[model samples]
Target: MRARPDSLFNLKKVLMNQPVSRSVSSQQQAAAPQSPQSPHAAGASGSPPRTFGSGHPPRIAIVSASWHADLVGQCRDAAVKGLEAAGPCHITHIHVPGAFETPLHALKLARSGQFDAVLACALVVDGGIYRHDFVAQAVIDGLMRAQMDTGVPVFSAVLTPLAFHEHAVHHQFFHEHLVHKGTELAAACVATLTSLRQIEALSS
Candidate 1:
């Protein structure tokens, strides 16, 4: 598939106003203060403990697909909340036209050496095109390749459902589900980065 310059250009426009440190709204900032002692810092109860070995905060890049803007936004917002609640961290959020475009952007960010971790979020549903499976698999494979090529630790929250209809019921259910997935993604990111940091320290 050819690259969509227009979509990428629009993404650049969105990123202009979003600083690299954090892309959260004022409401989220107010809701999640920078506190290391928060109970949710270790992630949902019973999850593995999260430890930040470095003095500086971890820098994360979140690349989200905008096909389902409303649902995707819910996930993004929840992720921001989870990340902030985890502890102080730098986050950069970017948007792409759709899931197909996320891999390239994610790979670019991972190669830049500016972020500790990279994440891709999208809701790829079967549109009766019969190519949803292919697209989803391609996206996931691309993300994995990006991580391996750059060694920057890439994570995916991309969800591909077998059936998704344009109705209030499905929409509501998926919206709520994406929010939960987003939070889980954030927790996983924290845990992974912490473990990598410890391993690096030991190696050094």
Candidate 2:
């Protein structure tokens, strides 16, 4: 695919005021705040440990951008391989214009209730300006919002590099890096969904 000159600066104007929260543990704590007057503390009931069941396969959706499809596709391929290896499931791939648009599509998919989880992957790079940071933050934040609103688990493999140039060496390195990232994301997806199931089982 021919590289677009303006692609690097494409999402600079979009999602300039959003922030990506990278602290998962902190978010969890905040989500479940403890009250001093409560009769039972968090985890008061010692429930039996539950394992991620393999009987029900999860449905997953992967949304990727078309701008850097060549490199971005590598991430998707790795994600699929990893997910399949982790547990057999129904996986779907969706294509969008760019990273800035991934969240909306992910929201739609999550809301449709057709999938157990959604994963967004992209390569947002600085193009001689501070816009890349904004775009990346917005996309990630948007994904989180979608997850919270829909009660669905969403994963992100979006990366923003401080130094990115149109060079053969850089391209080769990031391509390999994305492969590892994809595997990590897949593992996270499976683990998270399994945990959610276990939590649901607690009430049942």
Candidate 3:
């Protein structure tokens, strides 16, 4: 599943060729005076980050599993709201039958070069008929492989709970939890993209 050397080189070239907005370039210059290794350089110095997609709205793709429609829907909604709040973005959502199908959809989207990032959302629970752990592991591995092979960033909101039951109380707890996780995923997605942009700027 490793990417060919030439493909990696092409990915690096594409990143370098991406346009940098004037505002982002200015922000990067402002932060240049700070210590290179400082963790708080961006925040403590009051300098804005060189965020990705500053030149244009980023294209994002989301793949969600529909097994537990009610629960998964909450996560998807929360994630969408969070991304919109962050900034302008073009989001495409696709639904699959279950968690096992999400990785394939994500891979296809990532390889298409149409999205800056991909998000996968699902709730993997023990159904008492098969090993949920194996399925979860495979899904995660596939997602990692997709990103690595295609040089695209992939974010996962796939959760595997040890004990889950069809009860009102359990549902309420998970509903709230998924919302929190979704929000966190949105933040991570933005932060990761911003960091990558900063790295690209530094290299250039």
lDDT of 1 by residue, 136-187 (tens): 9999999999999999999998888766777886787778878988998888
Local distance difference test scores for all models: 0.83, 0.80, 0.82
lDDT score, residue 189, model 2?
86
| TM-score attained by model 3 | 0.75
Clashes of each: 0, 0, 0
- Measured by TM-score, the strongest candidate is 1
TM-score of each: 0.76, 0.73, 0.75
Model 2 / residue 105 / CA error / Å? 0.6
Ordering by lDDT: 1, 3, 2
TM-score of 2: 0.73
lDDT of 2: 0.80
Per-residue alpha-carbon lDDT of candidate 3 for residues 1-204, written as tens digits (9 for 90 to 100): 988656644533343233333335777888877646565454666333333457568889999999998999889888888888878889999999999999999999999989989999998988999998899999999999999999889999998876787787668767877888788778778777777776878999
Please tell me which predicted candidate would have the highest lDDT against the true structure.
Answer: 1
